[model samples]
Target: MEPGTARIAVDLLGGDDAPAVVVDGALRAMRADPDLHLLLVGPTEVADALIAALDPAERARITVRPVRSAVGMADHPSAARSESTVRAAVTAVRDGTADALVSAGATGATVTAAVLGLGRWPEIRQPALVATLPAVAGPVVLLDVGGSLEPRPATLARHAVLGAAYAAVAHSVVAPRVGLLSVGTEAGKGDRVRRATDPLLAVEPLPCGARYVGLVEGYDVALGARADVVVTDGFTGNVLLKAIEGAYAMAGGPPVGGGAPRAAALLGVAGTVVVCHGSARADDVASGIALAAHLWRRRATELVSALLDGDAATDRTDRSTDTEVRTS
Candidate 1:
C-alpha cells in the first residue's frame, strides 16, 4: 500500500490449518498488495493450489520454494529436523530471495530459526518478540511477548531501547514514553527482574528522543495513558498479551481503535521476520505477512540497528571520560 516492492517468504505449512489457511492468507496479501511478491514455501501441491486460484496478473508475483517438511506446533522445537518450512523461509530472507518472512508456527521454532539463520544484533543476547496494540491514545508497543521467556535484567533494559526505536520508526511515535510493565506504578513493585531493570532503563539513553516513564501497570498497556512502549519479561508479557486478546473477544469484538494483533515482530534479528499465533486464522496469517512487508519497506530493522550502535558508542565515551576523571 505504501508503493514499494516487498518480496515475502510465507511458510505454507506453519499454522494449525497448514496449507489451507496459509494459502488463503497468501492470496489475500497478494491481492491487497499489488507490489508484493511472495515465495510460497511448502509442498509443491499446496503452492500449486494457491497458484491456480490467482489471476494471471497476481500469478506473476508469486514464486514457489517447494519445501515438503514441517514441524507442527506440538513437535519439539529443538528436534533435529533439517528441512522445516520455517527454516527454509529464513533461508530465503538470508539469501536475498525474499525481503522478509512470515510464519504462523511455534514461536520457539521461528525465533530459533531466525537467530540461527540471520544472526543477532551486537550486544543483543536475548532477542525480543514485539507486539503493537492499538490504544485509545495511539499504538502501544509491548515487547518480549515470547522471544525470551525469562530474560535477565539487562535484557529487559535492552528491550526498552528496541521498543522505543521501533515505535518511533514503524509507528511514528514521537518522543515515545517508555515504561516497565509491573504490578503497580511504584518503583519497587513487580518481580525481581522488573525491580532490577527499572533503574537500568531510567539511566539508559533511548534513541528517537524517547525517555523512560518509570513503572506502569497493565492498564497503561491498553489505555496508552502512560507509556508508548512497555517492556517486560517474555513469560509475563506473553501471558498478558493472551489475556488482553481473550478480554477483547469476550467483549464481542475489539474497541473502535483496534484489537490486539495476532502476530508479533521479532526484534534483534538481522532480518525482517513476523510470527503469527500458532492457531492463526487466514486473516491472521495475512496480517502477519503484511506486517513483515511493512517492516521491510520501512527498513525498520536496519534503522533500529544503527540507533543501537550509536547509543552504544555514546555509552563507551561516557564511561571512558568517567574513568579518566577517577584517575585524575
Candidate 2:
C-alpha cells in the first residue's frame, strides 16, 4: 500500500504446507500492495498456479525464478548450503535482483542462508532475529527471538544497542527505553547471564537517542509500560515470544492492535530478510511478505548497520558461560 515499489523474493516451498500456503500468501500480498512485485523462487508449476489465479493487472507484477530444490523442515540448517529454494532467494537479494526476501521455512535454515549469502555486520558476530509486538502504549521491539540462543554477555549488550536503534528507526520511538528481560525487575534478579549483561547494558551507548532502562519482567513485553526494546538471550527470547502468543490465543485473541508477530525481521545480516513461522498460514505468509516489503522500503538493514558503525565497543566481560539453547 505504500508509495514505493518493493520487489520481494519469496521461497515458494519454504513453509510447512509448501507451495500451497506460500502461493496463497503470495497471492494475498500481491493483491494487498499495488507496488509489490514478487519473484517466486520455487517450482515452475507453483509459480504458474499463482500466475493463473491473478488477473492481468496483478499478473504483470509477478516474476518467477524456478528452483526445484527445497530443504525439508527437519533437515539440518547447513542444508541451505545446497541449491535449495531458500538459498536461491538469498542469492536474489545479494545479487540485487530483489529488494528483500521472505520465507516460512525452518528458522535455522533461513538464518543460515542469510548469514552465508548476505554476510553479517562487522561488529555483529551473532546476527539477531527481531520481532515487534504491538503493546498497549506502542510497539515493543524484542530481539534474539531465535538467532543466537546462547550468546555471551557481550552479545546481549550488543543486541540492546541493535534493538534501541531498531525502535528509533523502524518504530519511531523517541529516546527509546531499552531493558534487559529477566526473572524480576530488580537489578540482580535473574541468572548469572542476566546479572552479567545488566551492568554491561547500563553502560552501552545506544544510537537514535536511546537509553537503557535497567531490568524488566516478562509482563512488560506485552504491556510495555517499562521499555520500548527488550533484550535477552535467544533461547529465553524465543520461549518468551511463543509464551506470549499462547497466552493471547488462550484469551480468545490478541490484544486490540494485534498479537505477537508470526514473522520476524533478521537484523545484523547485510540484507532485508523476513523469517515467518514454519507452520505459517496464508495470513502469516502474507504478513511476512508485507513485513519484508516494509523493511526493504525503509532500508532497515542498511540503516541499522549505519547506526552501529560509530559506536565504540563495550568492555563487556566474557561471561558467555553456557546454556542449553541451540543455534545454527
Which candidate number would show the highest lDDT if scored against the true structure? 1
TM-score of each: 0.93, 0.91
- Please provide, for model 2 over 191-277, each residue's C-alpha lDDT reduced to its tens digit, 9 standing for 90 to 100: 999999998887676777787899999999889999999998889889999999999999999989999999999999999999998
The collision pairs in model 1 are none
Task: Provide the RMSD of all predictions against the true structure, rounded to 1 decimal.
Answer: 4.4, 6.5
Q: How many clashes in each structure?
A: 0, 0
Model 1 misplacement above 4 A: 68-83, 316-328
Compared with the true structure, model 2 gives a TM-score of 0.91
Model 2 RMSD in angstroms: 6.5
Cα shift from native, residue 247, model 2 (Å): 0.9
